[model samples]
Target chain A: MKLDSAGLEILSGGECLNLLASAPIGRIVFTDRALPAVQPVNFCLLDGNIVIRTAPGSKLAAAARNAVVAFEADDFDATFRTGWSVTAVGHARAVSEPEEIARLSALPLTPWVPGTHDHFIVMAPEQISGRRLSR
Target chain B: MKLDSAGLEILSGGECLNLLASAPIGRIVFTDRALPAVQPVNFCLLDGNIVIRTAPGSKLAAAARNAVVAFEADDFDATFRTGWSVTAVGHARAVSEPEEIARLSALPLTPWVPGTHDHFIVMAPEQISGRRLSR
Candidate 1:
């Protein structure tokens, strides 16, 4: 679909989801201390949810406790002027089952920051939506 | 400071803050439904905090219940390759006081989404950090 904006193109649903599945990193959006917040997170798609590992006292641990939040992943190539974004709105909670933790740990996501990866936060989507912009 | 990325020049602290102050729209990040989430929010900088209006059943109302979330705002001009980003990390909570709500409503922030603007989420930053990239 063509977007009204100059040099903007809307992507099909299949193409948008494909971009999301292939992208390794995305940004998570939430409220921190009563304001808007975002952070770059390395995540993997597991059982139709986004899984991320964090430190005990990290922001991720604090934001995922029994609340609804939004997660977005996007890929942009300036040279090509092509980009796609996938947003998931869902509830966030900690994954504490020993077996689940072990399984999640096996995923390819590794925290670039130095810390113990004890806190596992998962975003389960109640609604999954996406859009793509291209030139 | 100089960043190695091409066409990406680091912004001074003051300049970055200025851009943040001027931008009227931004995206909020949090965890929801067990994953990372993001939503576009209209906000105003008030007393060293970011404030937004939302519906009671909306995602914003859910993410801010009790979490450490990250909030970020950025402005970019592709033609000039100039942009700046401001990110805040802090706790989120509901504002229940009648006097405070009345005061906050007076701010320029008006919810564009259709709903009762009954939920007021605030993000009080423990740390405010920002960066700007210019050509």
Candidate 2:
């Protein structure tokens, strides 16, 4: 395993994707009012793309329209300080076509909140990286 | 319990701070190379300011210098779809004064990774808001 300058193990592309696929919740970072804002979201990986189901006309859905955003997920044991973090930088675009939405609707995408979350935002990562730290 | 248009309970300032005080870790949103990025950092509340200890010359340390960044913390039962999220938008400034740094070093803020984490960044929230979602 290759180690970064920070002593954390650098995860390969496959390792990063596998780790991302295992986590149920992740954080999405976007420019809100010209400042950085983060919102925790439950997301899933579909066809190697990060897919998010959010409420229509929501802040996230509006800000994520064809914009470059960052997605991060991790599982860390605060007690032991041993964990892995995966971050994907991508262009987030809303899926408006019916055929495309229909295909994504078949996925296991479920929102934690009880609301109308028909808007689908798919992010195809341009850069994916992660690191693993051992206690 | 006051509810927003989305039906989530709007938490008061006291409630927000109490919830933030209970979390061991949170995600810091800051602009990186002209794009938004999120990194999970273990933090603590000091005099109602969000304090984080990180490597001296780290990316987070550099980007967070005297900038308006957003900090978010939450505790959620993903399975039951219940949780609360608190977000604080504030200006992040590096604590350079020896006496100030010395005081912050005394806090319970401990970095998850082992290293020389003497640099301190304190964010005094200008706008703090949060909401709780029920199962």
User: Which stretch of 10 consecutive residues in model 1 chain B shows the poorest summed lDDT?
Assistant: B3-12
Over B1-135, each residue of candidate 2 has an lDDT whose tens digit, in order, gives 998766789999999999999988888899889877888888989889999999999999999999999998887777787899999999999999999999999998877776689999999998898999986
Which runs in model 2 stand beyond 4 Å of their true positions? Answer: none
**Per-residue alpha-carbon lDDT of model 2 for A37-134, expressed as tens digits?**
78888888988999999999899998999999999998887778889989999999999999999998999988777779899999999999999988
In DockQ, how does model 2 score against the reference complex? Answer: 0.66
Which CAPRI tier for candidate 1? incorrect
| lDDT (Cα, tens digit) per residue for candidate 1, span A1-135 | 665222234555555557667876566776666655676566778877888887777665787676777777765553454555677777888988999999998887776444477678988877776655544
Q: Please, what is the whole-model Cα lDDT of each candidate in the order they appear?
A: 0.68, 0.89
Summed backbone clashes in each candidate are 44, 0
- Native contacts matched by each model: 0.39, 0.56
What are the C-alpha RMSDs, in order, of all predicted structures?
9.4, 1.3
For residues B30-67, write the lDDT of model 1, one tens digit per residue: 66665656755667778777787888776668777877
Candidate 1 to truth, TM: 0.55
